[model samples]
Structures are given as structure tokens and as C-alpha cells.
Target: MPYSITVNGAVREVDVDPDTPLLWVIRDNLGLTGTKFGCGVAQCGACTVHVDGQPRRSCALPVSRLGNRQVTTIEGADGPEAKAVQAAWAARDVPQCGYCQSGQVMSAIALLREVKKPDDKAIDLAMNGNICRCATYVRIRAAIHDAAKALEA
Candidate 1:
């Protein structure tokens, strides 16, 4: 089946089964490899992407269900929040293995977009499922705070 979906501000076509996970389509069909596959069941946030500006787990989302919704992966993550998050991530040295950083960044950007100045509790609530193998939670929280501050300035 051929499905037409908007990704990264562009309409893209992919030929695959209706049940094919969006992650594979984004990575294999569209050649966008920023989204990672951690837990296929959606337990981990490695496959997090923005589906219509909301963070969604691409690993569990079926391509056919996308309809006309827009998908934003790490490759296409832009704008002020994205820049602030990326800068804060780099300045705080947030990534260790670097595998989960894409999803982490995606989640962080979404959170920052909704919450201008997220406290520790809000950060914890927002980044609940993104698991970093190297256990960089402290730095991740700090980076989110830093990004929030940068956005404030």
C-alpha cells in the first residue's frame, strides 16, 4: 500500500503494508534515521517523534493511521525551542552513548514548547519514558532547565 503523509514539513510517499510501523517507514522508506528503535512496545522513547506537534512513539504507530497528520523527526527538529534545546544539550553534555539523545531531544523540545519554564517536577513528568542507558538523568534535567533559561533570555 502507498501512504501519503506529511513529514518534516513535506509530503512524502511510502509503499508498505498498512501495519508497518511508522519508525521503519521514516528510517527505511524515507531514509531518515534520526528516530531510533529501542522498545518496539513503546516502553522506551527512542522512537519519539512529533505527530502534529505532540510527542508520539513512532515504533508503535502504524503508518496507515497517520492520515494527514504531520510528522517531525529529529532531523527536521528546528525553530527556537529546538535550537535552545540543542544548545543546552551540548553545553550540558547530555548525551553519553548518544543513541537516545534524538528522542530525548524531541521530548525536551515538545516539553519546552508547551511549558516555557518547566520546573523539576514538570520536567520529570514530561520526560517520563525517555530512557538513557548511560543514566544521564541529572544532566538531562539540568539541560532542560538551561534551555528554559535560554529561551527566557
Candidate 2:
């Protein structure tokens, strides 16, 4: 089946099975490999992306289910919040294996977008689903706070 989906402001037509995970289409067909596939199930946030500005797990999202909604991957996150998050992650040295950083950053950007100055509780709730095997939770929390500060600056 050929499904037309808009990704990162570009409309693309990809031919694949309807049930094919959007992650594969984005990575294999569109050649956008920034979104990692950690678990294939929605359990891990490695394939997190924005579907109409809301973060979603692409690994389990079927391409056919994506109608006219816009998909934004890490490559599309260039807003002030994303920039701050990126800088904060770098400043805090958050990533350990670096495999899950893309999803972590995406989730962090979404969290900051919703809560300007998120408290630890808010951050915990928003980031609860994203699992970093390196257990960089401390640094992740610190980076989120730093990103909030950066946004305030």
C-alpha cells in the first residue's frame, strides 16, 4: 500500500504494508534514521516522535493509521525548547550509551513545551515512560532543569 504522510514539513509517499511500523518507513524508506528502535513495542521510548505536536511511539504506530497528521522526528525539533534541551543535555552530559538520547531529548522537548518550568514531579510524570538503561535519571532531571533555565534566559 502507498501511504502519504507529512513528515518534518515534507509530504512523502511511501509504499509498504499498511501494518508496517512508521519507524521503519521513516528510517528505511525516507532514510531518516535519527529515531532509534529499542524495543519495537511501545514499552521503550526510543522511537518517540511528534504526531501533530504530540509525542507518540513510532515503533508501534502503523503507517496507515497516520492520516493527515504531521510527524516530527528529532530532526524536526528545532524550537527554542528543543535547542535549550539539546544544550542542557550536552551541558549536563546526560547520555551514557547515546542510543536512547534521541527519544529522551524528544520527550524532554515535549515536556518543556507543556510545562515551562517543570517541577521534579512533573518531569518524572512526563519522562516516566522513557527508559535509559544507563540509568542517567539524575542527569536527565538536572538537564531538564537546566533546559528550563536556559529557556528562561
Please give each candidate's TM-score.
0.99, 0.98
lDDT of 2: 0.94
TM-score of 2: 0.98
| Cα lDDT computed for each candidate against the true fold | 0.96, 0.94
Best candidate, lDDT-wise? Answer: 1
lDDT of 1 by residue, 1-153 (tens): 999999999999889999999999999999999999998999899999999999999999999999999999999999999999999999998898999999999999999999999999999999999999999999999999999999999
lDDT, candidate 2, 5-100, per-residue tens: 999999999999999999999999999999999999998899999998888999999999999999999988888999999999999999989988
Which regions in candidate 1 have their CA more than 4 angstroms from the true location? Answer: none
**Number of colliding residue pairs in each model:** 0, 0
In candidate 1, list every pair of residues with a backbone clash.
Answer: none
Least accurate 10 contiguous residues by lDDT in model 1: 92-101
